[model samples]
Target: MSGPVYFVSGIDTGIGKTFATGYLAKLWSEHGKKVITQKLIQTGNVDISEDIQQHREIMGMGWFPEDMTKLTMPEIFTYPASPHLATKIDAREIDFQKIADATLQLAEKYDVVLLEGAGGLMVPLTTELLTIDYIAQKKFPVILVSSGRLGSINHTLLSLEALKIRGLPLYALAYNLNDESQDAIISKDTSEYLKTYLAQNFPNAQWIDIPVVQHKDPLMD
Candidate 1:
């Protein structure tokens, strides 16, 4: 077809987008599909932390189609803030054209490409454009990842609303259990509640529960 599946933005940052993307990539590769993972925009790259390196190693071990190092990981800002702010501090600007060009290039090379966004859905990459807006224009079915926490219900609902506003196709919604303490109470209950809400509000959205794991490799499953 056109290319591999694309992962879309979420309601907020630190919601395990990278972890979820790596897991999906590894899972697809295990199924014998040639896959590639792209950060799209990575910040706070200080000597390649374990998180970033793990993705590279997982893709390599899985025998993915292309070299992990060659994948598109642009907008390497020093600050771990939003892309716009991070770039501003360094007197740099994010070139949406360059990011788009790289993404399309990877789409041409791989059977399944896992594209990861920097932050939340409304996080701005440029003055005029948000990540979600760009992904909507691409018209790829989104695999939105959310957390199981106090405000997950609201966050998930708002995220879905943003997608609807942008007219993006949502493939699924993955409720990731990133925090263990929250699992027994907040995590479990919130997920159930969100599942019900999504069924009634966004019937087309598939709800998936990603089990809590100790390491990044768990995501590969």
Candidate 2:
């Protein structure tokens, strides 16, 4: 059977979606599962981002099957913008169907596939569809990666609401503490407040703490 879990979307761009995806993949790998990762619609790929390389290194030498990288990561774009904007600048279209197919193929082969979204949940993949819509269609349990920062509460709540409207299965909410000193109140109370609020509104969702670390280390603590 295919894997049962997939990371759906992050709260915003550069919110450690890759780091979290790598950490989750590493965790599964330690458990002796054939773990793989995919960066669907990777943008600003100059020579492969640090996040992709981190995943490969975490998999270790010779442990990664060739098909894992080849099948998983496709549609690398150079412009650091939304897929719609980036693809337009590059004179191409976002072939989301190809991404969906590739992810499914990897899931069919590997024990777990950590599919990372390009941007926020509502970021447009095409003219009509958003990233969260793709996740809902794929029917993957979502794990939202958020950060402890100013306006995080509103962003997280809006993202949660969008997912709810789409009727997606939100597995958990990971409030990553990337910015330790944003605003005193935000840095201190965002996680606790979100956890309590989500528990009340989305009872099925759990809150996980992902501490910010240097050198792209796993979320261990």
Candidate 3:
């Protein structure tokens, strides 16, 4: 398959990386591309991989030819924590070579691979391997998801700086994930502000706004 692997990471957890990954996959599939998603490690969910589940649910039906979750996320744990701590909780260890091999194998099977990372860029994949380390090793284009909420500037900028240090090309998207029904301290203008800021400061970097999906998306339902 054609190679267009996007390594999706967030400035922080719960910043819509998983949702954005699914949305991108759906878009590619709609354009008649064979799209697949990969999440190296999924935590918190005991029975299933929550990120891939949401991705498949949003991508709707028939997008995947077979059971894709097993191929995508080969490593998962029940603990709701970082990969290192989560594996520790499970009394196991994360084999870097194993993850690297699995990732390489998946890249050979699909037209576009959306590889979503857990937590933030700095989140440890193992004791020594950070999420960014994986991206750097694979050399995939980075898709940085940022929560368009208060204090997003600090978080997003910090992430951008790190990517720059690693010389990683990043496509940024700012969105509000989770329940928006409650009156929360969300910044309505943050998305636009972030786009403008990135344009002014890091002119080459791409920043986009993903429309917030309600709790029950009619399109997915």
Q: What are the RMSD figures for all models against the true structure? A: 3.2, 3.2, 3.5
TM-score of model 1 (CA atoms)? 0.84
RMSD of 1: 3.2
lDDT of 2 by residue, 1-221 (tens): 37765764787776777767776777668889988887777777754544566666655633355334555667777888888788878888877678777777777888887877888888987778888877877778888988777777888899988888888888888777654445777677887788888889889887777655675435221
Off by over 4 Å in 2: 46-50, 58-63, 67-69, 182-185, 216-221
lDDT of each: 0.70, 0.73, 0.74
Which runs of model 1 end up more than 4 angstroms from their true locations? 46-52, 58-70, 180-183, 216-221
Q: Where is the poorest 10-residue window by lDDT in model 3?
A: 174-183
Can you write out model 3's per-residue Cα lDDT over 1-221, one digit (the tens) per residue? Answer: 25678888887766677778888888779999988887778887775577787888878854354245466767779899999899989998876676666666667877888888898899997888888988898788888877655677688889988988998887655454541323354565665667777788677766655566766443221
lDDT of 1 by residue, 145-205 (tens): 8877677678778888888887887788877776323457876787778788888877898
Ranking by TM-score: 2, 3, 1
Better of 1 and 2 by lDDT: 2
Show pairs that collide, candidate 3: none
Q: Residue 152 CA error for candidate 1 (Å)? A: 0.8
